[model samples]
Target: MKKILVPFCLFLVTLAYSQDDLLKSLDSTQTEESYSTATFKALQLVTLQTTKMPAKKEFYFVVSHRFGTVKDGFDSFFGLDNATTKLGGIYGVTDWLAVSLSRHTLNKMYETGLKYRVARQNDNFPLDIVGYSVADINTFLEKDQYPGLEFKHRMTYVQQVLLSRKISEKFSLELVPSFIHKNLYNPDIERDNQFSFGGGGRYKITKRLSVNLEYMHNFDKPDFYKNPLSVGLDVETGGHVFQLIFTNSQSMSESGYLTNASGDWGKGDFFFGFNLYRVF
Candidate 1:
């Protein structure tokens, strides 16, 4: 609730901006520059379920720090690795589609992805939902393991759909059904090569901010596998978006982080991360 209060207060502050009263003052006068300013100002006024509310063009950069054990070296290194930093980017095209590229500086692995809002054309419900697909190539891994097995070392792919509906002014829910595939699998080490399901939600405290929670469950194996649950917040100010969040997973990439998150929230292994979004 502490997170909700700050933005709710800011929402109230926007109503009274230096005696201009942004909510009450509107210059109905029409001009080329006036229409441009009005359109931008209008879009900036609304809080959106999907980040893809229309824009001339959109660009976002997200940086995060992880304060938990690195997944790969946990068993061999006794899990004493230092915390790591990661950076990511997102670009919007035509307001219906967006492309993203992200990488972790620690291991140099990169992920390229895309998100497209298929049915955003409908006006009744905001954004209906969004669909995103990602393909990850683990550059840190060896190119060839077994002899003549070069084809098996290709990149992994994950596809997910984020469906959300606003229940009320202060409440919303999202459902995410996901699929993950690995071109190369090790039988001795146990990995999933099938589909998965997840869901998430948002609760708005004001017009410009909201809290988020999401969970994903894998149905392949039960003994060594665990589900991932995350809680985060989204805040919008002018052209900037801030996401402050905490979660049990720390892998940083969609394929590495979301699928293979081994940290347990009950064990006090959660970490803090922030996403900063800006457009030009």
Candidate 2:
């Protein structure tokens, strides 16, 4: 609730100022501040969410895959032999909000999320702020393996604030502050509640292609679990976006990558992945 207040207030303020006021006593006409467009070409940059929302009534289908660690060399076929996939759909309920549902192969997780535009970058406004929240259920746990397993043990949730700025025609940057909660977790390996900060950006090298990079730091991560780092190339086609990515994490879900990334970049332990999105 604390996080929702500020953005909701800002949204009202921005919406108010963006219109022409009737109290034009001094000036004959008022200039309306229009919202910025295309700050980002996609809703996601690498592994972090961006301040982009689908247009009202628009719908999209998303397919994402993350391969196993490449450090195993030919034995594991450079991560190609072992892969995890996610299939999802996103629909814009209004210009300011969208809803999504997805299923992931890892732990057989089912996810549902909301993304909303709280504020936009317009004349005199320097930032685009958006909110994202999701809840997931890990269905892979077996009661036989853990006799005490319960329904509540499978739940996890994530909330994030996505802040972004389009600095120029060729570059855009984003910062994400995230919060995660898990009902069941190993105390020794990770915390039930975790916080992480993510930084990512995109630089257009050509009209149809751009380079993207993202890194996330967990404030409470244990020593052995490594932070995730990712780099990718974004390819824009007529009605779709294809992203080719390289990263030190195999799980694409928010809580999965943020807290459970096991691969180490130093040891060449990372996966090759791709995201394909089609909008209609």
Candidate 3:
């Protein structure tokens, strides 16, 4: 699936209209309104979620791929030898509510989540507030390895509140306060309930392109687990958003990235990945 999906994403890039053509009307609309539009072009920013949802009844398909640490250089084919893939679909049940389902190859993880826009950054509001609830199951755990494994041991849940603002015409910022619950975990390493604070920003360099940066600080992570930091570029072309990222995170799920990020940017321990979101 990784082989096919990765190539398919690249193929779509070739068929998209030039960036300039898609943003021709960008300058024509300069009226400042209380409710912002296109604060972030995509629904995601690297490893973080953005305060954007599809239109009512609209659907979106997303493909994400993360390669191994590039520190090995040519020894590991620049991380191509060990790659992980995630495939997901999202649907907006209403203009303010969305639900998503995803499967990640790592840990044989399956995740489902709901997003609701509780508040919009309008004249009466100061920010765009979105609430998220997600749950995931890890099917990779083996009963043989753990003599006493239960269904609950494989479960994890996450709750996050996304607060964001379009600071200016060319900049947008978001803050994510996340609460993670693990049904089973190692006491020696961490606790069952964990909290992390994350911040991300998008600086528009052009109407169709922007630079994004995200970082998360886990207050309860073990010493060995480094904070996840991701920097990427979002290329918007009509119904598709292509993201090219360099991140110190190997996991695509919220629980995984928040507490289990294993890479370190200082040592060049980072992965190269891309996320392709297509509107259907």
Off by over 4 Å in 3: 1-34
Candidate 3, poorest ten consecutive residues by summed lDDT: 15-24
251: Cα error in model 3, Å = 0.6
lDDT of 2 at 142: 96
122 Cα displacement, candidate 3 (Å): 1.3
TM-score of each: 0.70, 0.88, 0.87
> Where does candidate 3 clash, by residue pair?
none
> Model 1, range 103-195, lDDT digits (tens) per residue?
876556677987876543122223345677888776666545555456346588888766555556676565566677877767666464755
Candidates 2 and 3, the one with greater lDDT: 3
Tens digit of lDDT per residue, candidate 3, span 208-247? 9999999988888899999889999999888899999999
181 in model 1: Cα distance from truth in Å?
0.5
lDDT of 1 at 178: 67
Q: What is the C-alpha lDDT of each candidate?
A: 0.58, 0.87, 0.88
Best by TM-score: 2
For residues 1-280, what per-residue lDDT tens digits would candidate 2 score against the true structure? 3465477559757855665542352234324336577778987898787898999999999999999889888998998899999999999999899999999999999999999987677654567889999999999999998799998999999999998889999999998878999999889887898888778999999999999999988887899888888999999999999999998889988889988888888878889999999999
- Candidate 1 regions exceeding 4 Å error are 1-56, 69-81, 121-127, 143-154, 189-192
Runs in model 2 deviating more than 4 A are 1-33
